[model samples]
Target: MLVLNSGSSSVKYQLLDMADGRRLAGGLAERIGESGGGGRIVHTSGDGGRRERTLPFPDHAAALGAVGEELRADGLGLDSPGLAAVGHRVVHGGTRFTEPTLVTDEVLEEVRALTPLAPLHNPANVTGIETARALRPDLPQVAVFDTAFHATLPEAAARYAVDRAVADRFSVRRYGFHGTSHQYVSRAAAGLLGREPSEVNVIVLHLGNGASASAVAGGVCVETSMGMTPLEGLVMGTRSGDLDPAVVFHLSRVGGLTMDEVDDLLNRRSGLVGLCGDNDMREIVRRREEGDREAAVAFDVYVHRLRKYIGAYTAVLGRVDALVFTAGVGENSAPVRAAATAGLEGLGITVDPELNAGRGGGARLVSPPGARVPVAVVPTDEEFEIARQAFALVGRSPR
Candidate 1:
């Protein structure tokens, strides 16, 4: 199975040879369809040198073709019999598509219709699916929606407190993003705890370039940070998460800005970049250690918002059995793990300084000895999850 996670400006692909449960090869193409745009697609077999190339890729289709060329370069092209299906990561599925879907023309049309809800993401995903289909007409393409896992969110949490008629007309509601990663890591966390997923209550923080928190009660999604889009969550690399809606009104009325300008300001120009001129946590920390007040405050703001959500979700769950962190910052930033949970010991959340600050990896607990609730750092594997889901669907009705 070849799982393709196509983003707005990048294409990440993995060829999974499920016969042996190994990813035969994988690679990515970034900055698609942009001037001076070039990317490298790298293919690696287990325990060997990676084959890499740098070249121009003008668009998604061309980017995907380049991936195919690289796969061929390694003598593992898409023509392999082990290639069972292609799964795509679609950003939004609206109120429909609650489950992983096999891509039919009708399904494609539905994805197209939902594009307005995720204008920047869905079109690129749709184009990738179409291009993959064109390249291998016989291959089955499955669209694994980022919104699918959050379908379990209750109506009270999903609905916005707006005019019902107006809200319904425009599909204005919470459609939390990062469903794939949340679902994957939560399940993995449950497995690590030796508990049935049905018995666990977890808070999953997917802190990466884009970040969000999810409250999983009894193994099901009850609430999530992102509301309708990826811009409504934790302070991110480039995104300003969870701001007052009135900021928009103020920007329009006081700053004399248009809706588009406000959108650009909040989504691109804001967050840590807007605050300290740095997005990566490592750099931010380095600057802070050097007594950079701006970086310190930015770091504080990032963890402050995260702490609030952890508390809010703990209240929502009433009792949290595990707090799991995943993705780049979540998995790597031990300082973040410590600071975010500082003074939360009463809430059954604690990070052992030595265990956390020390070395090791692979979804282990960081909580102190005999802590009531365990804190874990589980690295996210969205592509692997996509491939598994795609393979399952294919096995049920093989193509």
Candidate 2:
């Protein structure tokens, strides 16, 4: 199976041998169609061989074609018979799509219509699906939505307390993002606890450049951090996680900022970078260690927001079985894991400092010997999850 995550300027792909869940090859095609764009593509094979090329490419089709050629060079072309289907990482599906869907004309049109819900994501997803379908007309393509997993959110959690008629007219409601990561992490947490997904309640914190938290009860997402967009959650690398709506109006009315300017401020110029001069957690940690007051405050704010959500989700779940951290920052930042759970001993949540500081690549407990709640670090594999979903869907298709 081929899992493709298409961004506005780049396409990230991974080819996997689902039979044994081993990665066959993967690469990225980036910098497509920008000014003086020298399209760059990097390919890595299963045995660790890598290749790269930089050249001018006009659009997604050209970039993808070159990527196919690179795959052909490794005898794993898109046309290979072994390739069953292509799975796409579509960022949003609204309330329409609730599962991995087989792409079709109607499906594509519906996804295109949903661009308003995910202006920065769904368009690229549509383009990727169209391009892949055109390239391999006979092959089946699946769209695995990032929002599909959160479709199960209860009305109380999903609805905004606003004028009902006006809210309905504008489709103004909470639709969480980072759902794929949340879903995978929650399930992996259950597995780490040696229990069925339906037997455990979990809170998954996906800390990366973009961060979000979710409360999963029996493998179903009941609550999530991001709402209506990916910008309303924990403090992220650049995006302001949660803020008063009045801030936007304040900036526009008093600060003489346009709506676009307000959007840019919240989505681009804020968060850790706004609080401090840096967005990278490692650098912020280094600065804090070196007695930088600004960095120390920023780190505290980030961790505080996380702890707040952890507590909120704990309430939502009612009986928390495990607290799991995933993604780039959550998996590697020992300080974050330790600090986020600190002082939560009253809630039966405590991270063993020595265990939290210990390093390993797999999911394991950082809680002390048989603590009340087990804290774990489970690396997320969204690509593999997409592949599994895509492969399962294809297997059930008519022969």
TM-score: which candidate is best?
2
Candidate 2: regions farther than 4 A off = 396-399
The collision pairs in model 2 are none
Give TM-scores for every candidate, taking all chains together and pairing residue i with residue i. 0.96, 0.98
Candidate 1 regions exceeding 4 Å error are 35-39, 396-399
For each candidate in the order shown, give its overall lDDT on alpha carbons: 0.89, 0.92
RMSD of each: 2.0, 1.7
Per-residue alpha-carbon lDDT of candidate 2 for residues 1-399, written as tens digits (9 for 90 to 100): 999998888999999988788889999999988778688999998999999999876788988898899889889998999899999999989888999999999999999998988899999989988989999999999999999899999999999999999988888888898877888888888888889999999999999999999999999999999999999989999999999999999999999999999989899989999999799999999999999999999999999999999999999999999999999999999999999998999899999989999999899899998899889999999998898888999984321
List, residue by residue over 126-148, the lDDT tens digit for candidate 1: 99998899989899999998998
Question: lDDT of candidate 2?
Answer: 0.92
- The local lDDT score (0 to 100) that residue 46 gets in candidate 2 is 91
